[model samples]
Target: MESVVLDEIDLSLIHALTIDGRAPFSRIAAVLGVSDQTVARRYRRLRRADVIRVVGRLDARRLGHVVWALRLRVAPGSANAVARALAKRPDTSYVQLASGGTEVLCGTEASSEHDHAQLLEQLTETRPVLAISAQCVLHVFRGGPAAWPALTTALDPGQAARLDPYPGVAPSEVVLDDGDRALLDALSVDGRAAHATIAHATGWHESTVRRRIDALRSAGALFVDVDIDERLLGVHANTLLLMSVAPAALSSVGEALAEHEQVAFAGATTGATNLVASLMCADVYALYDYLTDRLAAIPAISSIETVPIVRTIKRGSIFGG
Candidate 1:
């Protein structure tokens, strides 16, 4: 895809949504000092171009789901087919082809141990798969709705405060009932779906639909995210870093990496290499500088392996072309 140049207002609009994906256009316009129609028009253009998408996702941990970061080495000719198959699963997200298209890396959420084991068994039985490794996430330092700062240009604190729709409290654990699941399913498709549409789908009153969604957002059990092709936003490279960090510095290193603007996702995982991070860079040379300068500055890292993302098959709940 050709890159699109973004002006201050364009970037501000994206930043505003990153702060709150479901914020009213009028509210965003007020924050960015533009007409509501302009904000709405630009958003429509971006969405239509596949430059940006808004989606609501459930916190897997709160839902009692085991999240796995899986890597698969497949036969040369089967990478695309295998990746598309994995993308179709309801539990998977961030599926991508990496290592010059010989491997696949993705995140999958399983409802239970049995479900996780079953998925692995199915993959292992596939004829094209040569080997696979699964790493269970122990701690998430960044990712999802909360990690939307990669495209951030600038926004005043006051504008941010006004834009935050769910500001009553920090997220808390909440159990989901059947109605909640129905609501979430709708949101997974479109976070900005109207309450009326959601009500119809869930067989509940519009007011009931609104109330349940509010509760979920307030509890931090669910949050909305905007998915934009980083290339369109001037980010030309993305890499996954597998790093071995000293046991005692795990938390500090993870937290520190989480603070970097290039880091789209960072986490501690159960594996030989304990730290995993996803970074977006301007290009390969920028990535090289980041690894040699920024990453090398970290005292705790003992070793590192970098895998450049060749293509993203899916992100959030939406599949890519």
Candidate 2:
């Protein structure tokens, strides 16, 4: 596929959306000093090219669900099939073929111990499976509800401030009722879907829809994220780093890694390798530089395993039909 060339306006628009996925075209235009029609047209063209999308995702942890990162070493020649199957499952996201197409890495949400067990059983029974390691995410230093800084750097501070949404409310326990589910279902498909459209789908008034969405965001129960093809930004290497860090320095190392511009996601997890990070780099050489210079500078890292992702089948979870 031909890579889409993003101009300055396109980059700024993407950065604006990352700040507020549902920001009106007029508002984004004002920030970028472009006409509303131009902003809307560029967005449509990008969407049509499958270069970018906005999705609303629920933070399962707020609802008492466990999020897991799974690494499955499958039989040769089966990674693609396995990844596609995993991507089709609604619970899985960031499904990818990695480690020379013999391994599949994905993130899943399990609502209960039984659900987690059932997923493990299913994977163990699948013919292509060879080995599996499931790591529960203990804490997320970055990623998931956080925009990638590399992508968002196009906008100047003033422009970003204008586009920034209000701060989220304090974290609190959130329970999902049927109405919330319906509203989230519509958002999963299009985070920028109009409130009136969502209300019609959910059988609620537009005002109610707006109120519910605001409440969800403020409570940290939901977030709108930008999903973009990295190739559009000249990213050619996507690698996952699994590291064993000194127990005493884990927090510092994780925090430091989260600040790196090349890192798209970094988190502490429960497993042999306590810290995991996903990197988007310009090329393999860039990745090498990161490993040798940036990563090597961190004395806390004892060992590292680099898995170059071959492809990403899905970027985020989508709820409902």
Candidate 3:
């Protein structure tokens, strides 16, 4: 695919969508000081070019699902096949070939005990699999529903405020039904889908669809996220940092990493490494600087293992093109 050259308007539009993926074009236009037609056209062009995609994702924690980060070491020359197979599973997301094509890293959401056991069984039985490690996400300091600051910085505070729709507190004891599942299926494909379109897919009235979605968002069970090609933002290097931190300073270190612009995702997990973070940089040199400078400044880190991602096969349950 050819690269899409983005100007200020394009960048601002992306920022606006990141703030509220389902925000009406007219509302975005008002904040951007452009016509509704211009905003719509720009979005269409970007979507067609695969520059940006809006997807609705269910919050596993809010839904009482367990999220696991998996690292699989495979025999030489089997990384791509292993990664692709993992990506095909509905429960897996963020599947990537990393560590010089010797390992596969991915995240999976298990909704039940059976699902969790099944995943482990499948991984253990897969041929050529040398080793496997699974980490249960204990706490998420950032990532998931949180938008990365790299694209969000294009909009000033005032503009961002105008585009932001206040998210109300989650209701206690939320649950999902068949209708909700159907609605989410449609939204996972196009978060910006019109109410009528979603209604058609879910066999619900448009008003019901709207109310259900609003309720889900309010309960923090559903969130809309913007997925873009990082290369378009000049991100040439992606690495995962697995660090063993002092247990006493784990929260502090994870919070500090979340504040870094280069850090896309940071969290605390149960594994050999207590802290795991994903970094996106302009180049390998920038990554090295972050490692030796910013990261080294933190005294809590006892050990660091850098895994450079070779290819990302999936993102947030959606396969990458």
Give per-residue CA lDDT, model 1, range 1-321, as digits (tens).
Answer: 435677788888888887888888999999899899999998888877777888888777666666789999999989999999998987787789996767988788877899889999999999999999999888888775555466665687888888888676877788888777788888877888999999999999998998888888888778787788888757878888999999999999999998888888888888889999988899999999999998989989999999888888887622110
Give one digit per residue, the lDDT tens place, for model 2 in 69-156.
9999999999999999998886785798885779999898887889999999999999999999999887777787777777788999
Off by over 4 Å in 2: 1-3, 317-321
> C-alpha displacement of 61 in model 1, angstroms?
3.0
For model 2 the TM-score comes to 0.94
- lDDT, candidate 1, at 264: 84
Top TM-score hit: 1
All candidates: CA RMSD in angstroms?
2.4, 2.5, 2.4
Candidate 3 structure quality by residue, lDDT tens digits, 120-139: 99899999789999988878
Residue runs of model 1 more than 4 Å from their true location after superposition: 1-3, 317-321
| Clashing pairs counted in every model | 0, 0, 0
TM-score of each prediction? 0.95, 0.94, 0.94
